[model samples]
Target: MILIGQYDSPFVRRVAIALRLYGFNFQHRPWSTFGDAELIAAYNPLRRVPTLVLDNGETLIESAMILDYLDELAGPEKALIAARGPQRRQCLKSCALATGLADKAVSLLYERVLRKDHPSQIWVERCEAQIGAVLDALEKERAAIASPFWFGTRIGHADVAVACALRFTGEAHAGVFDDVRHPALADHASRCEAMQVFREFVQPLIPPKG
Candidate 1:
């Protein structure tokens, strides 16, 4: 198995963290979507990061799909997500919120960097509001949970997703994630990031291009 993409990407980082936790031995290619678009396109025409090449010459695109396949490979007991019922729904919801927040952060970053001269304040405000809303919702959910992870004692998909998203949000948009404003999420992210798996696959945010 091979994992492609820079760890700076929250999507790619999540997948990489999961692979380590699952004990999969694979190659890591820190390819940038901007600098290595053509190379990535050979495997994923969309040229997206977090593209996983399976052992048997098959390729997987998108972080979610790659994670689904990995969970299947790990089987029911070791799967990161709950196998059924309300547990699965709750986990998915949190993951959705976290990933959505990450998307908005990325979009806002592009707006400022790519359109520096005429960035739309209205659009930027909308993205900031979305980011804040998601953070509030996640912080509330996290605060109500007593477990070290989102799902009881064991870490799960939601934990990884939220942690990765929070890291990216903070790195890409400084001062956006205030520890005082969102203490629960701040603590949650801190714990997850302290893990060896996370530390092993870490990368600094890529500077924005003009």
Candidate 2:
């Protein structure tokens, strides 16, 4: 298996971290969508990161689809998400919120950094509000949980997604997301980052040049 994309992206980072947790041995391409657009497009027409090349020469695009495939490969007992029922719904909700937060952060970042000549203040403001709302909701949900992870004692997809999103949000929009206001989320991110899997796959964000 080959994992293509830089870890700076929350989407890619989550997939990489999951591969590590699942004990999957694969190659890391660390390709940038900006510099390696053509190469990535060959595998993913959308030209997106977190593209996974399976051992059988099949390519998987999108973080969610890649994760679902991986979960199946790992089998039901070892899957990161619950097989079914209320737990599955809750887990998916948390992951959705985190991924949505990451999407807004990336959008906000592009609006500010990529659109230097004609940046839209309105779009930036909307993205900021969405990011804030996701953070507030996630923080409250995390605070109510007594377990170390989003789902009981074991680490799951939601935990990885939230941690990756938080890290990317902080890196892309420094000083915007206040750690003081989200103590639970702050602490949760710290714990996840401390894990060996996360530490090993970590990469710093590299904003586009102006």
Candidate 3:
């Protein structure tokens, strides 16, 4: 199996960290959708990073889809998410929100970094507001997470999602994350960053660009 993308991408980092946690052995190819457009397009025409090539040479695109597929591979007993229930729905919802936050962050950064013409300040303000709102919501959610993991007693997709999102935001805008604004979120992110799998696989890197 092969995982393509640099860890600089929070989306790619999430997949890598999950692969590590799941104890899956895969070859890591640090491909970028920017300079390596052709390489990424070979597996994902959308030219997105973090494309996973299964052992049989099947390619998986989209972080969410890749994660669900990987979760299924965990077998019934070791599934990352609860098999069924309202709790499961709530957990999935939180994960969605977290990933959405990360997506917005990436959009904002690209707007600032990629475009030759400056992106609209109004749009940037709107996205930043959304980021703040989501972080606040996550703070409340974290307070309710009694266990070390996000969803429940076991580590799950929800935890992976939240951790990756926070990791991205924190790295992109240093000192933006703190106990004052998001105590629970700060604590949760700190704990996750200290994990062996996370520390080894998910830290921000020297971002490879075109």
Query: Relative to the true structure, how large is the alpha-carbon lDDT of every model?
Result: 0.95, 0.94, 0.82
Backbone clash pairs for candidate 2 read: none
The local lDDT score (0 to 100) that residue 138 gets in candidate 3 is: 89
lDDT of 2 by residue, 5-106 (tens): 999999999999999999999999988999999999999999999999998999999999999999999999999999999999999999999999999999
Q: Which window of ten consecutive residues has the lowest lDDT sum in model 1?
A: 201-210
TM-score of each: 0.98, 0.98, 0.93
Regions more than 4 Å wrong, model 3: 203-210
lDDT per residue for candidate 3 within 3-89, as digits (tens), equals 999887888988998888788899999887787889889899999978999999999998988988888897657777777898779
| Model 1: pairs clashing at backbone N, Cα or C within 3 Å | none
Across 1-210, the per-residue lDDT of candidate 1 in tens digits comes to: 999999999999999999999989999988999899999999999999889999898999999999999999999999999899999999999999999999999999999999999999999999999999999999999999999999999999999999999999999999999999999999999999999999998899976698
Off by over 4 Å in 2: none
Error (Å) of candidate 3 at residue 210 is 8.9
Superposed on all Cα atoms, model 3 deviates from the true structure by an RMSD in Å of: 1.8
Query: Which residue pairs in candidate 3 collide?
Result: none
